[model samples]
Target chain A: MTDVQTQPAISTAQPEDFFQLLKPRVMSLVVFTAATGLVVAPGSINPLVAAIAVLCIAVGAGAAGALNMALEGETDALMRRTRGRPVAAGRVKKNDAMAFGVILSLFSVMLLGMNANWLAAGLLAMTIVYYAGFYTLLLKRRTPQNIVIGGAAGAFPPVIGWAAATGQAPWQAWLLFAIIFLWTPPHSWALALYSAGDYAKAGIPMMPVAKGAKSTRLQILLYTLVFVPVAIAPAFVGLGGLIYLVVSVAGGLGFLGLALRLYRSRAGDEPDKAEAVGREAALYDVRAQAKPARDLFAFSILYLMALFSALLVEALSGLGA
Target chain B: MRLTPEELRARKRRNVWIAAALVAFIVLVFGTTVLRLQQNQASERALLEAATGTTAQ
Candidate 1:
């Protein structure tokens, strides 16, 4: 067997090395969701405070990611997808990464409490724990349902942002939370479908690895089915306008179509076919994973940005009237 | 893949440095937030007092 073992070494750390620890990709999603919460809330938060809250959320997310990297450095080195990460590549020491993570975590929570509200700070703290402790340390290694459960960590930002604005979690905050929660499984499993072998090689039990590819595809379809209504639910609740309803429904249907295609492709059957599906799925995952979680991943970012942009527009229009 | 003693010691030292740096960074962030929060609270209080036209506690 090829040695999956990593050497212990601390090479000269590059600026990019530290940046990667923050998981910029994940930070973008967190920032957007948190900003959405601040924008769509009933009351106006000082722009300065809103900005601070967003920064804290971003920093807190980065800290959690750094800790995850520290904890999973060994496994990451074994996985093709994460082998190049600074910690996994032995460019950064695991302990250093952990220390950085812990310090940032404390700072983020304290700052959020002082600037925004204790409730926001508490939620941010829970998000760090959920991602770094519950998801990374435990769920990821333990089960195929990892992303499903771990997705909660990502979903909490909107709620935290809402609390920052309103100082309480409202049903509206939860509706936004629900949209992301349901979106997580399909969003991640698509990537997992492509990275199944990588995950399996690393001994990580992702859905495709534990269950068959067929089961993973089915779950993607199932979650996408539930995701559609949730995505558009804001319209009925008055959080969105007619424009939002139309866009959300159209986008939801488009997402469902993609999920359906993914299901029908049964593209996971042939190893050769896997690459084709991976390419197709990668198109979506890359875009969505970016900021919005929409052009498979790019469009995903746009999809969400547009959704919240609509809400902001509605708020502005209401104020004008 | 086992780490030699020297490598382990180096790792420990690096971790300590990183920890110190992170602590300093966090402290700066916290201080900035507290300052901002105090300013906001003061402004809000002033606004409320002006609107009421009284020395509201």
Candidate 2:
């Protein structure tokens, strides 16, 4: 038998490449959610403390993304969607990335503990571990429900921000958490439906790859249905107001309608046709599936941002009142 | 593509330095802020106590 090599050859690291591993887009979302949490809480946190808390959350988010890049680099290289990532592209070495992530993690946690409450800092630390260690390293490679369960990492920012302000987590903080938890599946599955081949090529068992397209679309619709009611629940809890209620209800209805349309469209038969003219009306069911899924993904982000922004406006107005 | 052992070690050294510098800067900024917050809290407490004492007298 020919000699079998188990390990692939590694490449050199670059200084600038380390920053690229941070997944800044994801970090920005985390920061925004965390800031909203801080602003909307009942009591006032010192401006300095609030600023520091947001900074800590952002750095912690970046650190987690960096560690994820390092651990998933090999798998990332195989997928077209992730092939251009810093670690995947060989611009950063795994060890260097790991070290960078660890250092940032430590600094962020320690600073948060000192500047804000230890409760908030501890939650931030746990969020990092949940994402980098539990989700990225373990859950991602093992199951189709990875994003569903792993979505907790993203959900924690608002809760952490609430804790940073109040020194304790409350039902309102958890309400925000539940919203993100429910939103993640449909949001991620929509993208997965469009990029199933990328996940399959990478040997990742995403929902679309493990199940059929019809099943994925059904799941997206089911989750969206479940998510809409929860999205509107904050109004009952007094965390939201008239503007939030109107925006969330309208946004939720739009989301459900789009998801329903996606479910009705069948793209499993002709993948190529789906990729090409999916946005246009077509006889082949592929276009029907692809377009609505893309629409849902784009709307989900806007939906969450708008809902939270409305809540922030209500909170600020309440403060003035 | 491959890198020589010397090149790898050099890269490693640079990364460590960069990480250390970032950590130091974050700590300094946050530590000063925490100190100021503590000072403000203490002064507020003192002022409240003085006001209560004056009212009682």
Best by lDDT: 2
lDDT tens digits, residue span B1-57, model 2: 565675677568767867787787667675757676786888887888797875322
Cα-based lDDT at residue B1, candidate 2: 56
- lDDT of model 2 at position A47: 84
Off by over 4 Å in 2: A1-16, A268-289, A319-321, B1-57
lDDT of 1 by residue, A77-182 (tens): 8765688898998888799789879988998898888888999999999999999999998899899999989999989999999999889999999999998888
Cα lDDT listed for each candidate = 0.79, 0.83
TM-score of each: 0.80, 0.84
- Whose TM-score is greatest here? 2
**Model 2 TM-score, 2 decimals:** 0.84
Candidate 1: stretches off by over 4 Å: A1-11, A272-302, A316-321, B1-57
Each predicted model: what fraction of the native A–B Cα contacts (within 8 Å) does it retain? 0.18, 0.18
RMSD of each: 6.3, 5.4
